[model samples]
Target: MRVRRAAKGVGDFVVESIGEAVAEVVLGVLACALLAGLALIAYLSWSFSPLLTVAGTGLLSLFLAHGAWGTFRDPVEGRRRRGWTAVAAVCFTLVAATAAFLLLYASDCGCL
Candidate 1:
């Protein structure tokens, strides 16, 4: 009975940890997107430098990629099959979507 309780506690901790990680990443991405969008609007209307536009988009893309990698890594980093959380899955999905959008924008291909 003691071993079972210990195992359950560990699993709960892992899941809670995963949730916190996912929430942080989501909040980060949302905040960045909002700020970036505002900056982009300002740049477009205020004749901000072309270099700044490129740099801003590049940085945002890198950030999204890192988030995606981190979220995916969190699931299978240390152990074989300890725990799985819906937050991790949701995080991956969100990151993947943002990454896909970036790919299309970078490629400038409508079909992509």
Candidate 2:
């Protein structure tokens, strides 16, 4: 009886862990999709306006950087998920660089 109970508990734990991992993966994918959609919409709406494009990209970069900072600062999450921290950092960096480039281009082109 004791052996069977232990086996069941272990199985349950494994299932729960897998479920949590799957949920996290799905949520991450959805978040990325949402961000991509927002970028596409911004591009379509602000294509002709350099300042507006810079504003949109800057806002997105700020949002990503904030998220990355939070992830890096969280004690439990920061320790448990180094990969996520790296991913967040990379995303923030890319978005920020894009925003900077857009701003520079706008200024240089006399569009600002």
TM, every model: 0.41, 0.44
Per-residue accuracy of model 1 over 61-107 as CA lDDT, tens digit each: 66656555555564665654223334444555776676665554434
- lDDT (0 to 1) per candidate: 0.63, 0.68
- RMSD of each candidate relative to the true structure: 16.0, 14.9
Worst 10 residues of 2 by lDDT: 103-112
lDDT of 2 at 27: 55
Count of clashing pairs, candidate 2? 0
**Model 2 residue 27 distance off true place after TM-score fit, in angstroms:** 0.1
What lDDT does model 1 reach? 0.63
Over 1-112, each residue of candidate 2 has an lDDT whose tens digit, in order, gives: 9999999999999999999999866655555555567568877878788888888778767768765795556577435545656676778777667656444433333212
